[model samples]
Structure formats: C-alpha cells, structure tokens
Target: MRCETRLYNALNDRMRRSHGVAASQYEFLRYLRDHPDTRVGDLAAFFAIGVGATSKGMDRLEGRGLVRRVPDPADRRSSLLELTDTGTQLVHEADETFGAIGALIQTALDPARLHDAAQTLRQLLTALEHDRIGTPAG
Candidate 1:
C-alpha cells in the first residue's frame, strides 16, 4: 500500500503538471483509446468502481472536451463512450509523460520481481472479481 500510494502520488503529480490531467483520468483515457464504444457500466465494472463514480468521471471528461457519450442503439438506457480527437492527442502526449515517469518503477525493481508482482496482482484481482468484492455497477 505504501509503495503503490507513493508511486501513484508521484505519477499523478507529474501527469497533472505535464498534461493538465490526473493519473486516474489519464488511465481512463488510455483505456478508452484502446477500447472504444465502451459503456459507463462496463467501465465501472472493469475498474471496480461504482456506476455513479464512473458517470461522474465521464461527466468531467466530457466537460473537458476529451470524450463524448453516444446513445447506444441497442440499449436505450446505456450510452457508449468515445474519445474525441483532442482526447486522443492528449492521451498520446500523456502516454509519453507516463512512460518517462514509469521508468522509476523499472529502476526500483528487477524485471523478474516486477513480473512476479504483476502476476500476483493479477491473481488477486481475479480473486476479487470472482468474489464480487465491490458493489455491482448495474
């Protein structure tokens, strides 16, 4: 917890300073860049957050002209999220900033240890998902 929080703080600060976007927001953008036409509930489920929180986050991004919510033809109550051109460009720049800051993590841990940690984390996440740790996004 201590190590992750410390690293997250540094990453967040640098991301905000360089891109006017928080690390959390950058993560959301990066995900959207890779997976377009995602719904808010889907994002909430993936991130293990509440649907309300996800919707609020989307609202902030939408207000920033970074993303837009399109009505889903298949689901009247659901909307698909997509990054705008500006959002795409911003994410591209932010990716560089993220990678540069992420070098510190690589420097701190050997590749083998890092790989082990990542695998452990993935296992933990899978366990949580199986157990349904958080409230459902609905």
Candidate 2:
C-alpha cells in the first residue's frame, strides 16, 4: 500500500508540474482520443466515477480547448466527446512524458524485478476491480 501510494504521489506530482494535468484527467483525454464519438454517460461508467465528476472534467477539457462536446444526432440531450488538434498534441506529449519515466525506471531498476513488480501490480488491480464489482475470483 505504501509503495502504491508513493508511486501515485510521484506520478501526480510529476504530471502536474510538467503537463498541468492529473492522471485521471489524462486518462479521460486518452479515452476520448481513442473513442472519438463516445457518450458522456459511457465515459462516466468506463471511468467508474460519478456523472457529475465526469461532467466537470469534460467542462474543464472544453474550457482548455482540448475537447469539444457535440450533441448526439440520435439523442439530442446526450453529447459525444471528441478531441481537438491541441488535445491530440497534449496526448502525445503525455505519452512521451510517461515513456521517459518508464525509461528512467528501467535504467534505475533491475529488469527482471521491474517486470515482476509490474505483473504483481496488475494482478492486484484486477483483484481489486473484481472485489469492487462483487465478483468472486476463481
């Protein structure tokens, strides 16, 4: 738990200082980039966050000219999210930033240990999500 918290804190601190974006915000942008016509409700569910929080992030992204909200043709009340050119650029920058961090860690740690740690973390996350959804793990 301490290790996870420290890693998250370090990542957040680096992201905020370097890109003025939090990890969750970056994730939201990435999702929009991948799914160009994604609905807001879908995004909220995908992120496992409340609709209000997702809406607020959308507003912030729109205010920064990174995302545009367009009304769905089929459903006038629902909106689809799409990334703008600036958003694309930011996403690329964020990817590069993360890549650099990965490279630094690779250089600092043993390759085998790092791989094992990553696998362990992945398993933990999967188990946690299963617990969150009240699913019994086999």
Candidate 3:
C-alpha cells in the first residue's frame, strides 16, 4: 500500500510539475475530450468519485483554461464540460507519461503475472462495488 501510494504521489507530483495538472484533472480532461458534452455528475460517475471532488478538480482545470463549464442545453442548472485546445494538448502529454509508466510496469512483471494481477484486482473491485464503500451523496 505504501508503494502504491508513493507511486501515485510521485506520478501526481511529476504530472503537476511537467503539465500543470494532476492525474484526476487529466482524467476529467480525457473524459471531456472523448465525450465532448458530458455533465459534471456524469463525469463524477465515470471517475467513480464524488461530485464535489470532481467539481473541485474541474475548478482547477477551468482555472488553467483547460476546460469550460457551460450550461447544459438540456438542463439549465446542469453544466456540460468540454476540453479546450490547451486541454487537448495536456491530455496528449499525460497520455505519453502514462504510456511510459505503463511500459515500465509491463517490463517489471511477467506477462502471466500481470494478467493474473489484473484479473484478481477486477474481481476484488467487483466484490467491493457490491459492498458499496464510500458511496457519494447527492
């Protein structure tokens, strides 16, 4: 757990230093890039995080001019998110960084072990999902 935490902390720090964004912010940007007009609530769901946390991440991205929160045409009170040009660039950069990390991970493990770990983690997550830990509020 400490190793995982350290890895993520380093990843986040590196991302912020190099790209001026956190992985969560990059994820939100990626989601918006792919989905174009997704709502904040939907983005929260996609990330499996609370709406407030997603909103806070979005606020940071918005401040960086990487994302825009426009009124949803279907719902006046709801905001639809989209990636700006700067966001597209940042997302691409993050993808490269992630790709490098992925390569490193892949090289560190045997193929069968990696596959087994992935399957085990997926099963664990499925079980946990049923138990519903840390469910978000409306």
| Model 1 lDDT tens row, 1-138 | 898899899999999999999999999999999997899887888888888999999999999999999999998888899999999999999998899766888898899998998899999989988998875646
Q: Can you tell me which runs of candidate 1 are displaced by over 4 Å? A: 135-138
Clash totals in order: 0, 0, 0
C-alpha-based local distance difference test score of model 1: 0.91
Alpha-carbon RMSD to native, per candidate: 1.7, 4.1, 2.0
lDDT of 2 by residue, 30-81 (tens): 8888887898777877766777778899999899999999889988988889
Which of 2 and 3 is the better model by TM-score?
3
Of 2 and 3, the candidate ahead on lDDT is 2
TM-score (C-alpha) between model 1 and the true structure: 0.91
TM-score of 3: 0.85
Candidate 3 clashes: the total is: 0
Q: How far is candidate 2 from the true structure (C-alpha RMSD, Å)?
A: 4.1
The C-alpha TM-scores of every prediction are 0.91, 0.78, 0.85
Off by over 4 Å in 2: 104-109, 127-138
Worst 10 residues of 2 by lDDT: 129-138
What lDDT score goes with residue 92 in model 2?
80
